[model samples]
Target chain A: MARQESLNVSSSPARRRGGRKPTISREQILRAAEKFAPEELSIPALAGSLGVTHAGIYHYFSSRAELVAAIAAHASRQLEPPPPGPWEDWLVEVAFVLRGHFSQFASTADLAAIGTSVTFAPLVEALLRVMRDAGFTIRQAGDASELIASCALGGAVVLQRPNFDAAALVEDLQVAEDSPVHELAASAVDDDADAAFRRRLAVVVAGLKASLEAPTAS
Target chain B: MARQESLNVSSSPARRRGGRKPTISREQILRAAEKFAPEELSIPALAGSLGVTHAGIYHYFSSRAELVAAIAAHASRQLEPPPPGPWEDWLVEVAFVLRGHFSQFASTADLAAIGTSVTFAPLVEALLRVMRDAGFTIRQAGDASELIASCALGGAVVLQRPNFDAAALVEDLQVAEDSPVHELAASAVDDDADAAFRRRLAVVVAGLKASLEAPTAS
Candidate 1:
């Protein structure tokens, strides 16, 4: 149904241009969008870059928000979770898939803030399947899915920021060398953002496993 | 030294007013700022609310960014961690304190994005101390602190967005009622944002415990 809707929208330009095939496909537009960072992507700019009129772009995506949503949908389709395996391995693959997706299209983070919940169904389904297979009840699996999705997207936002200098922030705070904040900042300098995210992911996975094993009070 | 610097800035107005004592103090201004949401906070707006001239506002905070930093610093001071206890209890308290702080000042989420590494020093110190007492090495403690902090702050960001209707999003996706996305969205509707966050925090704490007890791979 979504594909049909996308096709109908994309074909409008060709229809208006007297039945000539549309000069551009939705896939081509998304590919062009992929070239710019989320912050730098604008429809007019994208159209200009593609050598198409602004109206041509608008025929497919009515507004920038719609374009962003389409981009998120496109990215979601590209995410190929590894073949089913141990729950732990499955989750690790999920995390890498998410990181790769968000890293490639940074603007998805912004969309997630507003409304990308629907676009995220595929990834959420994959996580849910893994958790359910690992013995989480439906309710538990749902909560876990939300938790993991939120963390991955949130972590991506932190990592994708234009400027994040832990050392500079520490210096601004004027903390002593022995302070915990100083230690954290110094350690952050040693590890890249991706490593830090993976460490966090490990903690989250471990935490979930322990919680699942413990008998619930209810 | 920080206190001296604050005094120097706050006292400038008094000196400019022929030593008659400034009509407002930095504390008074901060008190007013605390009443407004972070996004609503502005130097001129705050000054207007306080019945002071815009110039009077600058006598203390030089810019909106400086004011936000001061607000974060002030919020940090107000975060009094409980005396040493079980690591779980300590982390739970930290999460609540952070959520309370960020919820009270919405813009702190934005600050957390930019430079929470500094503002969060006290809470980080408290968490580090608790983790160390629980037998985590310095490096492990540092990584755990970052993970927990990131989760708490990141969760807060997700919760604080202006409009988040999971059901509406599900409807927009046009998924069948039995579909995994529908199930996830429906389940999400049943759990309030705070409960979801607490669940995630529980997982982080559990993860930390498991990691600490596991024999080091190194």
Candidate 2:
């Protein structure tokens, strides 16, 4: 795909004026942008890092938002389509893959916010397929897919944060010392975030399954 | 609580050196900090906005991190504790309250990532209480509370983004034009984010109930 994109850029009429056809391609720019994302993903910033003019970068991506969308698309390509299986199993895999993909970049949630659904087409398709296979009507599948996808994306955002020291903060506040809340916070001090993610995914999957089995509301 | 905090500040050794006892209190500082949070929530920013020296703000919040925690705590206080009820009903209310609270602030996810667990203590207690009352063992209650909380926080983050015009973006990409994914994206153009949240919450609640009934794993 990168090679195809590079070829398309090289063949385009917008090639820079007589400068030996700029070496960078859109894929290359997106690669560089991903490396600096969430902090320095702007076009000018990317250009500065690549030793290219800002306009030179624009030849490949028409605007900064386009560039961001491309990077998000690039990152999302990491998610493999789900193999044939029950919808719950498929969703579990999808959640894990998404959590892993988005956790790598600080800007994952931000980029996702701006990214068009095209970037997430494969994952969305897989989710919808599973929901349908699970016997949900098209409307139910659509709503379930959105809900599940949102939960996964949201979970990734929370898990990607630096481990929050609930214990230290509780001590600082000097309140809720003996409360169940304190115990929960204290336990998180040694929490494995990935394991917690899997458990939450299970909850979401379980919920969807139960909802499916329940009689439809009149 | 605000009155007590004021008394503590006025009587402290760090009290402003005999000039007017510095009128602002910690609660006042926290309120101001939250008002500008997620963008201008830093110590220097808060100080500048309050027309006070940086050191003056420190007298209230020992560091920038503390100020962030205080602000998260302040925002969380908006969550009224759920009235006594069935555990599932209680959790549903918790999810809605949290989703509502975080959605109102643009920088909610960012602030939440940095805010300490103490900031979420009250909400956590409420969730744990409900889970326990629902007959989940202590460990189960802890895990379920975390799962439910993550889902709520994550849902809020995803829903808070300006709607991605999925249909428009798909048109721009010009691929998957006739795909189920495309239909899904098109439908999102008019999605009611709140209704979707309720549906997802139902899934999580159902999942938790199922897990509780399942035999304990050895």
Candidate 3:
């Protein structure tokens, strides 16, 4: 009975938070910033919209850049955990998740681009860990991480815009018979971009292994 | 003799404007915009820096957006035409030229993003013409042009960042011993990335053709 009532209340129109002590949490702040992005949004404007003081925000974020970084971190964390499987298969799964995550929060890419100076190091380090565990040497891990993220993020940014639809973009690839954009598609000259991605992934992995085998340049 | 004097007068810092009159021209305005992009750069700032009244710009560009669009068009025309060859062989060549073009004008990508809205229709038509001429079917030409342009442009935007050293980025992929970045010694992962890009491009091309052959779902 309590669960049913809570669901009903949660689904109702958002309550106007005026008459009470503003209980703005970090999540709420991040959510607000994400909502107002790609527009002429300012920290003060966000605070005003949330019925909170600008000064109060400093309790959570030290600066506007920091706030943007926090939002990026929040958005990045929203991505699902990489699936448990063979390294090759899991790598593709991870790329797909990343593609979806970036698509969902495409505006955040621009916001994150501006705030990159803050501390993407932590997130980058985490990414490296995933790659290492997936059988990549540190250097191979580094390049693979950068390339994968770039493709996914770049693809999402293109997909989210008005002129670029993500599904249509994938459909254009005509990758597989059962599911054209699915993992089953063969690497045709014009149809299977995923095949191209996998080939690239394999090369990076092989290169990394070769580099590891020969530490010094020949 | 006048041309010789103009070319040789470089020893003298002081030279008359083009060894002729200072009358305004469309080329002159656009050239000035390109030259002044590195400094004070608002519409008014560009006009002021050029020692012209803001209204004076209207003779060449009717609006600020038009002025920006013209600069982008100028840069686009100045870009190296994609090399004529096998698709894979020339694709990286195209990517390199695009990277250089975007890097030349720091904010040109952002401007192009805005300008594509106004120019997409005509641009698409021209792109289709080029692709068809290059051995693609009407549909393959249409879809491939859009997808490939997006990839190249998106790659450029990501690669032209302050942290992204293009020389370093491509070093691993160059197979030739004489390549400059090859001296930098690419990580195994970077080699893989080069391979992956080739595969991805192939897939995109093949998929595009396949999609052309099949009827798209309703």
Candidate 4:
């Protein structure tokens, strides 16, 4: 509970009791962080696992916000989507990459949660940059980025959530027999979910292009 | 909290003590519901406001879930988007209509919350029927619908939440001055929020159109 200022933890690994140095690195911290969900990430808990004080964790990230940002940025860097050739394909690639990331943690990200806006800044930047490269003006890019984020998050929800199941949803519906929903159920054939999401992503990218006749940015 | 079976409530307004009939109607209940946010809605609280026992409220809605669904449906019924002119336009109209509805209560609908999927069934049915009439296969329409829902919900969050302020967000950015995000801020001029959302909705519609060469449903 105490700040433990006596612990001389700084840039490098800290000197423990008896001056024994522990070899900790940014890579080590990030790797350890991977084990916990983003919401579960705690500097004190993390330091405990690494055999260090919370101050030692602070050495790598000056604040908890900084630490979360680092994790987000790290993930962004690791993304290897198809080179931003055609902007639409790039968006599709990024959306799928995001799905992979969302699925990895089995975490439904609460975009409305405090600090989440910052957490997604790296993502928003990457999306905007890619669209800009394709000639979207900052205005166009910014507006479209918000829409794409929505699709990406929404796609993740539809794909991962059990409530979205076609048959189950049909079964749970409160509509009557004469309802068009009954007719709709007959058409609810099984679909390749990944393919379905990619199609939606394409629709979003294509829609963005259609909204802007040509890339308006310099 | 008591059931109060002695209150003698049913389809007609209940007779309170001394044989005086209290004429509480569904319209009265719905008008009152408009005052509370969706998450704040409570049956017992609502009944107390209407001067009815819980059983009397049940006469109108069998359960809390039914009451919520009724509220959702009532809202949906009140929506009058520009008629389904072109399929793209239809989707755009619905998106804007949805924006109006979401903004009315300052609600960001938790599509992931339990029973929300059921609550949205009416909205979904309408969306699918319009797309179907426009010749979209069920699969294309379903996929497109999910993406559009994302845009609608995401738009509400960005437009309503203070955290989305571009200047404030830029100030909070941990990126270096050399970052592209810095350049992005210069282009962050004020925009007509409604127009921006419409453009994105248009984009979504256009993308959906582009994805399918032609609708293949019977």
TM-scores, one per candidate: 0.66, 0.72, 0.46, 0.62
Choose 1 or 3, whichever is better by DockQ. Answer: 1
Report lDDT (CA) for all predictions. Answer: 0.65, 0.62, 0.48, 0.61
Residues B1-218 of candidate 4: C-alpha lDDT, one tens digit per residue: 22333335353444343344445678888889778766678887887777766666777787665565566557765666466577777777777766555444333232232113323456667787778777677777777667766776666656665434455446644566655676666665555667778767767777777766645422
After superposition, which runs of candidate 2 have C-alpha atoms over 4 Å from their true positions?
A1-29, A37-44, A50-70, A106-119, A161-163, A185-191, B1-29, B37-45, B52-70, B107-119, B161-164, B186-191
Summarize candidate 2's per-residue lDDT along B125-151 as a digit string, tens digits: 777777766787666777676555555
Model 2 C-alpha RMSD vs. true structure (Å) is 7.6
* CAPRI grade, predicted model 3: incorrect
In terms of lDDT, the best-performing candidate is: 1
Better of 3 and 4 by lDDT: 4
Better of 2 and 4 by TM-score: 2
- In terms of DockQ, which candidate is stronger, 1 or 4? 4
Rank list by DockQ: 2, 4, 1, 3
Clashing pairs in 4: A207-B203
The interface root-mean-square deviation of each model, in the order shown, is 4.3, 4.3, 11.3, 4.2
TM match of model 2 to true structure: 0.72
- Candidate 4 residue A107 C-alpha distance from true site, Å: 7.6
Query: Cα miss at B187, model 2 (Å)?
Result: 4.6
lDDT tens digits by residue: candidate 4, A1-218: 12222223322223233433335666688789877776678888799888987766776665554455456546655655556567777777777776665444323222332113323356667777787787777777876767766666566556556445555556765566655566555655555667768767777777777766745433
